[model samples]
Target: MYTRLGVVEYPEIDTHRTTRLFTTDFNNTFILFLQLICFSGSLTKSSLLEAVRMLATYRVHRLPVIDPISLDPVGVLTPKRILRFLWHHGQDIFQPSHCIKTPKQLNIGTWKGIHVVYPHTPLIDCLDILLNMGVSSVPVVEHLTLRVIDAYCRCDAMNIAMQNEDFKLKINVKQALEFKTFATDRACAVIVSEAESFYKVICKLVETNVHRAFIINCSSVIRGIVSISDVMKAVVLEPGSHLNSYCISHRRFAEFLFETPTMETQAEEVDNEDTKTSCTSRSSSRTLS
Candidate 1:
């Protein structure tokens, strides 16, 4: 059985603050986000593929895998991980029908040891982890048990970069919290359980207008992450699946403000600076391999 997650209430966008933060400087602060739905663990390959279609349509980056009984998240999936998996395991997906027989046909264990950060970490420091690490997002987990808590993604990085000039000197995740910047609400993350089929997860992703869904086990413990990239790779391997037909293609809500070339350039430069960070060289080999 699959669980259908929905947006109970709409997220109120602080357009004025977001605009000012992008336009001016530290003079402005605060970003608000709402909660989202979850998917089940029992999702099959078709359902997984569908989830990817939904993500492509919605332009979401991550998928949280959830448990059936406990409903806890087990893993977080991303496009890069999916691409890497497909690159490593080409034989299984390229069958006669160009289709996956089951969700287990693909190996999902690759993301189990991905890097993560604590919720209390400073925003600048977190940005350092993401930019230098080349990973799209980082999950906030309990240090002792590695249990999932929250996430910080490229979208979040872009938000901070917008204020780079004003906040260039010093800032932390806690400071962003003090000002209510970004959607810190766990509700914004979409959840999925192991029992749900891939098709159901995909439908939920589209129905809820979210970018990613969380996958969890019975104890609500995270097992693996899934993303649109993962699903698209499935479609690409299967042929004639036509993933783009699912949802409308548009810029993500997080990217609404940076339409101009200058802003775009600034954003790219901010992201690229991670390369020069002290940690990039040290971790690049490990992260890529």
Candidate 2:
């Protein structure tokens, strides 16, 4: 099913514009700044497996499901919705379930080359790291201990749009985490232990409604991160049980899941080799998709 509408992104919107302009009256006219010529990746009546693969490959959070005849978006697909569906129906689908295995056994998530930020890191600098590194979130660590205290996510960046310009310039990562733009904004890092079952990980992600969770050791040092994309990949792409029949019969199910209003459907599709290299290199890292 489509999880979101269509995907359009403004990669050039810097921290300044995201903070000052998003909440201003000019927000309505902000679409003018978007590059209209960009051709984003899209799907047309594809299989669930294909959707899952595309989502992981492109490192996108959502993709539009286009009506073949009208070329208008019928729905959007997202990793979270896919996981939710799997969480409910996974037992019926998989033979000899992989869900019970640990992420280490399944070889899921990112383990190496994780980009992290210290609590004292400038908020703008942290934002820059997110944008430059093309990562959805970064663990905020204590400088001396290297222990994860919190996280700075793309969702947190949205809160910056509601803050004053001076607040944006002066705040550090710790301060950013403490400041609440809305009542629901005060979220800590979602974490899972390395020894935890994959089922428990899914439970954590679905329960928290977060995209990814940092995998920590006994000391709470981040070892890896498992994203909804990784979870989807483990189930849908796992070596052979019985998916062909299910995938064939579930087109309507997919449609119903992905179907939603077509208003806010913009996501970025990175095509450059550099981006591919980055994504491939940091395969264990969390992506918005």
Summing lDDT over every window of 10 consecutive residues in candidate 2, give the lowest-scoring window.
33-42
Compared with the true structure, all predictions reach lDDT values of 0.47, 0.64
How many residue pairs collide in each prediction? 57, 18
lDDT of 1 by residue, 1-289 (tens): 2111222322322121222212212211211111112232322222445555445544456665544345456776665555455545644554443232323335422235556565555565566666776556666655555556666677666554456345431344545544435655535446577566555454455555444556666766555565555556554524647543332222332234334366557545654654354244435433322
lDDT of 1 at 132: 75
Q: Mind sharing the TM-score for model 2?
A: 0.65
Candidate 1 C-alpha error for residue 200, in Å: 2.8
